[model samples]
Target: MKIQFLNQEHETKFQELRLGMAEYYRNNKEYLSVVYIMAGNEELHRKMNRYFNTKEGMFSSDDMFNEEDFSSGNRILAKLAVHLFNDNETVSPLDIISALDDEWFQLALNAIHFRRYGISSGYDFPEEKLYM
Candidate 1:
């Protein structure tokens, strides 16, 4: 995501947060698949960092990228996501959220909910046309 730190300190904090999440899932390793999509936004990253970098929360965006262009899409986390999603095995919501490269926590939440509810792509939530 496009993450712009107000200063170097903020940048450092962001990195710490991202790395912390990565380490958590690496140790757990209990899932069939995971996919992390990075939003690639600087402001969003900073906002997320400020909002999530809390002691009692499940989300954070510290150590976020300076810009979407700076991110290497083929990082260890990305690889893991590919492996997990392709394997078709049940995974952990927290674990999956931790692996996300993107700063968009909402997507992470959606991923967790989707998996928990057993709904794949193209599957409507209620199986009905709401507009009709």
Candidate 2:
């Protein structure tokens, strides 16, 4: 489950995605706060609540993940990917193998990971894994 940049191009794309995601989060902190709460980040939820002087409301994980405003969905997916895989200097692609429960997140992670690493499964497979 290790993830490594396939080459310079892959590393560059990953860096670009990290920067874009950082910008997205900075510009949409409130929305992302809600997402973090729904993603089970209690510490983030508390920090956001105190920072924003607000409390959690009726938002659900589905609502946050399925947000259709601007590229919120993509941003949310990226945030989750960061949360789940941004540990260690190099991540094991297998780290995300068990996250197939959420099909959308799985798809998004695979897409992002593949776009940045030139591989989807991180494991051996007969056919080429291409994510659309």
Candidate 3:
């Protein structure tokens, strides 16, 4: 399924916001990912005891990518929607994930417990999809 916007203006505004982000890395081939520290599993969080550039509050679940992310495929997008157009609504970021493709998604999930996370999301991405 695809994102269903409120209307033409809503779609236009969302596209513009995404385009602004996309333009920021037009010539750059490198990619990075958001490392989220979820609200649960404190024991595991402490056992690992390592974090860099992690933002807390909500987590990205494997279930998130499949069909949902609790709130709008992820809360981040919902927040952005609220901030950007005052729309206060969002579809799942799975659309963004789909743009990133499935292999990268699986690779990203696999790396969650790794001590050293890779710079790029995953390999074998096509030119268009390489935007990350």
lDDT of each: 0.34, 0.36, 0.29
TM-score of each: 0.24, 0.22, 0.21
Which residue pairs clash within candidate 3?
Answer: none
Please give, for residues 25-112, the per-residue lDDT of candidate 1 as tens digits: 4222222113122222343343333433224323322232222222332233333333334432234555546654443334444333
Residue 47 Cα positional deviation in candidate 2, in Å, after optimal superposition? 26
**Cα RMSDs, all models:** 16.6, 13.9, 15.6
Candidate whose TM-score is highest? 1
Q: Which number leads on lDDT?
A: 2
What global local distance difference test value does model 3 have? 0.29
Q: Report the Cα lDDT for residue 20, model 1.
A: 51
Q: What is the lDDT of residue 7 in candidate 2?
A: 38
Per-residue lDDT value at 52 in model 1: 33
Q: Alpha carbon lDDT of residue 84, candidate 2? A: 36
Per-residue lDDT of model 3, residues 1-132, tens digit only: 122233344335433323333443322221112211121212222322232112222233322334433332234422222222223334344553654334333323322322134323233323332121
The clash count of every prediction, one per candidate, is 15, 7, 0
Q: What is the lDDT of candidate 2?
A: 0.36
